[model samples]
Target: MAKEKLNYIHIIVTVYVLQLGVDMFRMSNMLAEDFGTNGWIAILIVSIFVVGIIYTIGLVYRLGEGKSIFEILENHLPKFMLYPFYLGVAVLWTLIGTFIGKHYIFVLQMLSFPTTSQSIFNGMLIFLAIILFSMGIYNMVKAATIFFFFTVWTIFVVAFYLPEFEFIRLTTHFFSGGDGYIKGFYRVFVTFFGFELVLLLFPYMQKNTPVFKATLIGHLLLTSAYVIASIVCFGVFSLYQLKYLLVPGLELLSYIELPFVERVESLIFNLFIGEVIVSIGFYFWGAQEMLIRLFRKHSKAKKAKKLTLALIAGIFVYSMQFDTLIQVHEMLHKLSLFHTAVIFGLPIVLLSLLFWEKRKEKKSNAKSI
Candidate 1:
């Protein structure tokens, strides 16, 4: 049977949701602390870099003829070269996803499940992600699309907090002498991290789909959302309040007073559950793709998927060793730096090799002709 193909819309929705989910929970507050009133400026600046990165990703996809990075490395490089590079990609993605998952569990522990075992929560998330992966990538996109709608209204919900925002909090000294702006820029840069999933998703997209256009739209959508969220949080809280907040976007929702719900932030957090699933699902799919490609001859084998799930579980168990939020955040910051290098640096290396290979091929063909 021929494989199913995902549309450009699926890519847009999945990437946007994945990026938005991480930023709302982990990034918005850190951004407020880093840039103070000028955080949105950092977001905008980083967005231009993001657009360039997305374009490079699309170009690399074209150069590789829509193969995932693993497939490209396999075809073009030796096993020794391939395994280490591919393994790093897989492990980095899995670790990043686990860190994000840990944050979510910690949030739940503080807000609702103080006495419940976090292991249970962690296991449940892993179980759900495996189920989603088993359904296939098409279904992952569909699930993300559904979740996109479920949680997108949270953007509108942010408007409720606007009345409390002190507009004066927007700084005139956006690029002041303090290193906070630079630090904030780096922190916010990670918020743009999830869009690199395109490197893996390229092969799954429908042949005629416009990958470039889809990614451009997706990056812009995420940029708008992040900038708005940062602005809202900066406006709502002073420097002192924002510096201490673990999840400022969630905290923003705390100020909402709806006639129906007593604790509005709780409702918002519940809605974000869908987004968490989608974000983790994207990473899981990437890790699963790399794992299967590395070990199995056939990508579609049931055994490969089972092994992938097992590996994901192992990574999750290892991540649980970092019990405290501080430890998890510190580790994530280091990983984020590494991730920036891998996602951008790996593609440039591949693209260079692809270019050299193409030139060599043209010369050989010219002689043969």
Candidate 2:
């Protein structure tokens, strides 16, 4: 088997741009509701915390050098413990991936295709995930590079409606009472979920590259994009009005009309279909990585690919059994806590242990030498 290589810059761009899409366009309003007008401030605070986490996770990756989180676990922990730990991470990502697909399908049904069957919508999304997952990480990174540019173009197009934004709505004092800031900060933390990809992809990064710089730039880009979109949403809709909306970015675009184009939201919504696909693709890939690490025997390239495809298919089937969108959303919210714990908490712990072991190894070598 040949070792696979990816451009460091492309990975950085993909991580940041994909992060922008994961939450920026869909949940800005929900964030604003939690933080009020100061939601962007709360986002900045949460991002600071995220930056610290990314740095620590990057440190772990740098120390391990050329190994995924699973490989690191296998090296440090007993084999029996490795499988259970990896399985927990896999289940966490799978549940989150299913929820993302469910939410996207629900958005499509409500905003554009009211008559479409939920199964058909979910099936299409699963198909996209399978195709991307079938391709190796190198190809996935390439696809993400192309889609990253498209996401930038979409942002510019969405910006065209800025002049029409009602300033009063944006200026209204939602945070005037100075309450809910802590709650809003936590919600913003939840929105930055995809940063965990750094841990999963760190092993594949080019050697000697500045991982922290890439991570920082990516974080800045995503945070800026989210703030801009949140401001746009606030400007276009009153705080009170935005409270009831699920997808405020879509709703904001719904108000803008061009000389020839009447339904701008529909076009934006179509673009969202691609964004959601990429988001889920990354999650699926993360789960696949976890599974590959757990079994230990099937890390061969061909077998790994087969397992990834199978896992995606299995999750899609599970998604189809849910009868209502609300049920999926509720499950997703509950699962997110677990996802955060395993993806973020476990890495921090594992990395600390790895560092301690390395220090012990160094001390022993010094005594021997």
Candidate 3:
């Protein structure tokens, strides 16, 4: 069977959905607690850093033009280096799955399933992610696009409760401290970490499409969403009140009383399960792609599919062995820097080298001619 071609819009939508995962809704609360009243300013500063990240990510995509990141690395780097790079990415994705799964469990406990075991909840999510990963990228992207719209509609429906927003309380001391704001800015920058997956998705896009435009629009949408969420959390709950909350966005909904529904927050929490599942599915697909490119020589789709299932099963088993969620989160946080380096940093270096080598080759050919 011929491989299906994905256009730029599909790639862009997949990237956007991956980035807007479960984290965005609660990231502001983490930033506010970390940076206090200066969180918004920190978010603004982080947005600037995101521009740099965006440029670097664009370079990675450019380097892998017409090829996936795995293929590009396999062609450019030696086998030894390539294997290590692939391993790093696979480990990073697995760690991400674990981290997100833990958070999902935390959210579930806080909202509805307080009696459930965290391990059981996490195991179930990991199992589901494994199933999704068994499906290839094309299917994953289709599912993501559908979920993306669902999440957007939910966001809008949830926004109607914004009338309960207490602006003065939220803005009581906006931008009071320069130092704290700077620290908060860095935290917000880290929150947008999932955009790095574009490295894997870019090559699958149709040639000559303006990927950067789609990405820019996506980032702007994400920023606006974050800002709105921050305002809602701040306006609805006092700083002291918010500090104790695990997921402030859901808590914000809990305070709202809709005539039609008494437990609107519960509904939003359920929707969030879908959002996180899609997000994890995308990451799992990326990890499988990287692994397949590194270890297998088979170009046949059926063989690749079988290999992907085996790998996901292995990852699921490994995910269950971690004794505690805190250990998993710590490993994820530390490993994320390596992911930043490979997904963002290595691409810039590779692209520069590729460009210089091409220019030199061109000059030599011109002289010879």
Compare the candidates by lDDT and give the number of the best one.
Answer: 1
- C-alpha TM-scores of all predictions: 0.91, 0.90, 0.86
Q: Which pairs of residues have clashing backbones in candidate 3?
A: 42-185
Q: Which lDDT values do the candidates have, in the order given?
A: 0.76, 0.72, 0.67
Candidate 2 segments exceeding 4 Å error? 1-4, 166-174, 177-179, 298-310
lDDT of 1: 0.76
> Which wins on TM-score, candidate 1 or candidate 3?
1
Better of 1 and 2 by TM-score: 1
List residue ranges in candidate 1 displaced over 4 A.
1-3, 176-179, 297-303
- The candidate maximizing TM-score is 1
1-369 in candidate 1: lDDT tens per residue?
998898888888877887875456646567656655465677788889888888888888788777767666777788877767666777887788777777777887887789998878877876777677678778888998998888776777777776677878765666433337667777777877788887777778888577778988978887887777777777777766776887877777777788999888787787777777767777877877776666666545566567666767788888878988788879889999888897788778779878987999999999999
TM-score (C-alpha, index-matched) for candidate 3: 0.86
Q: Candidate 2: give the clashing pairs.
A: none
Could you tally the backbone clashes for each prediction? 0, 0, 1
Error of 1 at 178 (Å): 5.0
Q: Looking at candidate 2, what is the lDDT of residue 139? A: 80
Instruction: Please write out the lDDT profile of model 3 over residues 66-97, one tens digit for every residue.
Output: 45655555555789877777767776776676
Candidate 3, residue 314: the lDDT equals 70
